[model samples]
Target: MQNRFRANARFGGQRAIVALMLREMSTTYGRSPGGYIWAILSPVAAIAFLSLAFSAFFHTPPIGNSFAMFYATGMVPFLMFNDIQNKVSQSLMYSKQLLAYPKVTFLDALIARFLLNFMTQLLVAYIIFGGTMLFFEGTLSIDILTVLDGLLLAAQLGLGIGTLNCFIYLRFPVWQQMWSVLSRPLFLVSCTMIMFDGIPEPFRDWLWWNPLVHVVGLVREGFYDGYDGYYISSKYVMLVAMVCFALGLLFLRRHHRDLFER
Candidate 1:
């Protein structure tokens, strides 16, 4: 009886997740004309613009011969982290109405949003990176495994931070704006456009704390064979991500009822 009950619970969770995914898709992508195509285009356009603008100023990229590829290496992973984190952070708020149903859990909402956004970002990354490599001449010396590893790290970090933010966001309304203002400098310091090696002085020591820096560094290391990502500490990034994720879950579990009542 217990085994049967477990199976039924698992099946019900899966069903709830699927339903949330469909609802998210319709609400998010359905409103737009192109639906998913805009997901591909938005990143492609940003990458192209950054590549062109930077190429004009600098003769060559920080490491690679192709600016588009160089930027894509950084931008895609960063954007993936950005999109997934934002999506997952908003999951609870978006699905609060559905959570009234006994079978629909907060976990289901979180998973549903994360899965849909992660898959979409993964597809976008493949298309953008593949297109850049194919059109550009020369050897990028791509290591597929290393690249995948970096991307997975990025996604994990996103999930962790996003999970934590979900609780904070609902609890404190002002945090939403505060995080936006504070995180603005992340793009400049995250080792996206600039290599860690190029950073000189005590500032480099401080910037190393940002988990996304480690993520961007590892990703660039994958794309550029010659570039060594000595600064990337996967362990450090994982620690930060895990801590945040755990705290987020704990917070949600303890206070979700209070929040729902409010």
Candidate 2:
């Protein structure tokens, strides 16, 4: 019975995923000099740079008086999405050697990387956001539920986009470079530096098409009681995420063998 249980694909897949996550932790973080500390600090340092660069210009953030708090709200989710997307896109490639084993499926690789990276980002976001509220001189009223929703939506978006890109990267290696270049503009327009309403009318309407704007708005809603972000639509973000994820799963299911061959 014990042996039979291990042979079941569902049971075996879970075990395989856990094992892969453990392997990734050691190889990805455990071997590094700063290890996980860097994960927490990288975003902090980036936020610090943003604060310094912009402080020379604006006396206060468009919405929040504290620039650090404002950017942290936006940057954490954006970074989470970026990190998860990059990590998930490379998941199968990173563990290509291990995929040779029959029990280890590509799904296992995706699941493992998504889980590990999402959890890591969550912890880092919590630490950064919590510390900012505690130490920074600002009034931040946190709605934990809203923050969780924003993070969840960000993770979902990342996983969905990354899953699709994983197959794309496998099929067309040049796409990797192309995507990196394209994503450069995301940081500038992701509402990290400013709020959704802060943008001019036509631009704000156009920017609403980007689901990330909604996620950031939702996050800020939780922080500021007077913040007016009734325009945020969680359903739209979920729909986009679901579509991408469904398409990714469909493509991977159909052409997984071809992906390996390429």
Candidate 3:
């Protein structure tokens, strides 16, 4: 029975993937009052609040008139990562009933959650960007392509971490809670609100080694031309993301059966 079920659990075509993603999306936010609107609004509000708070404390603009823009670029991707991690960590427990279905593999849940968060993040980022550009008359550039590239990198980073966490959650349920506690402070160190250039040389070098910092630096490069002077290693970021992805897949493949039992 287990072998047969595994055989039937391979990823299906685009149509099946789309249907599964939609089902997961609806199940995730549809029961609430605002449903999908809340998903969009919550991140926007958080970014705005963070921008305001930081703007006051720093006593200087973080990114010129584009402080909100800077914050949005970082916040949207970080929130997407956090959301995917949270959703994927609990995916097995939430989809325990659906696991009985032959088509709904453990991977499908992770993929669906990742896709949903990716789409939602992209939508929110664009909306905020567009509104800021129009209303605030912010500086515009032809670097939109770079922004897209950065978004892809962010998505890869999120998907890689989220997939690994799925396996960790299945193997050790306590890891989910532990991860939440550890990730909060790490967000501050991620160079989301502050530019890599702002840090002292020694700490700046250390922050440059962080993959999340590279991701943010890449996004900033797309937004501001001068940002390339900072120390960002896109190759390092990609390598880290790829390593996480490969290890996560191996872990999942080896322990998939264990997930079903738990």
Question: Best lDDT goes to which candidate?
Answer: 1
Q: Could you estimate the TM-score for every candidate?
A: 0.97, 0.95, 0.87
TM-score of 3: 0.87
lDDT comparison, 1 vs 2, better candidate: 1
lDDT tens readout by residue for model 2, 42-112: 99999889888898898987776777888898899999989999999989899999998999998999999
For candidate 3, write residues 125-214 as lDDT tens digits. 788778766765366673888778777887888777777777888888899889889888767888887777888978887777678787
Clashing pairs in 2: none
lDDT of model 3, residue 8: 56
What local lDDT score does residue 223 receive in model 2, on the 0 to 100 scale? 85
Off by over 4 Å in 3: 1-16, 57-60
Q: How far is candidate 1 from the true structure (C-alpha RMSD, Å)?
A: 1.1
CA displacement after TM-score superposition, residue 60 of candidate 1 (Å) = 0.8
Q: What is the C-alpha lDDT of each candidate?
A: 0.89, 0.88, 0.73
Rank all candidate structures by their lDDT, best first, as comma-separated numbers: 1, 2, 3
lDDT of 1 by residue, 149-211 (tens): 899999999999999999999898689889889878877888888888888988889998999
